[model samples]
Target chain A: SAVISQKPSRDICQRGTSLTIQCQVDSQVTMMFWYRQQPGQSLTLIATANQGSEATYESGFVIDKFPISRPNLTFSTLTVSNMSPEDSSIYLCSAECSGNTIYFGEGSWLTVV
Target chain B: SQQGEEDPQALSIQEGENATMNCSYKTSINNLQWYRQNSGRGLVHLILIRSNEREKHSGRLRVTLDTSKKSSSLLITASRAADTASYFCAPFSSNTGKLIFGQGTTLQVKP
Candidate 1:
């Protein structure tokens, strides 16, 4: 399995400020997924980041609010824009490996006050 | 509604006892996987059961998949206090790596 690392493990930002979380994988992968877990909630798929293309967002997520960028196969970034208190949650990134297994990053915890 | 949903959102058991968590999905999946999350940390992959496989085991964890019913169950034998965590089932196998995680079952194993 591939090892994933996420930057800014935890952060506190003021409302209306945006924060970008970065995810890096040890090896190049074809697809990277971003997920959001609100306090006391399950993980929700935010978007799919594929290198060299626009990200595919889930129904409730918008590119403007949660913009994603995957400049290459091994790295991707998710930015929470125009943040609000409601945006406080844990953001995680995962990469798919051989045998259909997925590995997750430590996750970035964001708090909008 | 999410594709995968887990039953008994929370569970409590005694150490050395067995713990079981069930998950049901709405769509056909190529494979199902179980993951464990400790408190506020990232998820750790526990086991993966392919659609064609009935059961799989890893260490103290056992996972069973029933494609006919679109459901899966995770069993932890000889449960320990360290097993207390949120267990989630993810539907993987689609060409897209994006996975739909179930609501998850919070298991608390009292020592």
Candidate 2:
């Protein structure tokens, strides 16, 4: 299992502003991903962070809105662009380890006012 | 990716009791994982069971995977107040390599 750390664990932002959440893994991982949990709903896959390449976004998530960058195997960032009140959610970063077991970070909780 | 369906949207039990939750997936999976999330907090990986394995135990948590039925179950023996949280099940082995999370079962352990 890999240890994941996320920055800006909790933050409050104004509508229309953008917030970038950083994720750092203790060791190199084969796969990195971003997930969003809105209010009481279950977490949804936002994108798959590919090192040295463009991230693959999931349905209902656009790169323009939730841009992700993975400069290396151990680090990635997710930026919520043009945020709205509806964009308030807990953003989580995860890495897949051996045997397809994934570990999650503490998560970045963003509240858009 | 197939999403898992968790049985019993919510559950309440007394301390020292055993808590059980079931999850069913629509597709075959290489691994199944159970996660716990405290209120407004991050996800905690509880246990992971592979398709080839039938049952696994870690401390007070026991997880069983039934690949033939595409379902799994998590049982927590001797539940405590700290065990109160949201339990979610996710099945791995998707062609897309993305994890689909179930709505989760909210477990409340009253002390």
Clashing pairs in 2: none
Mark the regions of model 1 whose C-alpha exceeds 4 Å error after superposition. Answer: none
Error of 2 at A101 (Å): 1.0
Residue pairs clashing in model 1 are none
How close is every model to the real structure, measured as TM-score? 0.96, 0.98
lDDT of 1 by residue, B26-69 (tens): 77788888899999999998888999999998989888999898
Give candidate 2 misplaced runs (Cα > 4 Å).
Answer: none
> What is the per-residue lDDT of model 2 for residues A21-68, given as tens digits with 9 covering 90 to 100?
999999999799999999989999999999989999988899999999
Candidate 2 residues B1-111, lDDT tens each?
389889989999999999999999988787888999999988899998988899999999999998888889999999999999999999988575768998999999999
Alpha carbon lDDT of each predicted model: 0.91, 0.93
Predicted structure 1: clash tally: 0
How much does each candidate deviate from the true structure in C-alpha RMSD?
1.3, 0.9
Clashes of each: 0, 0
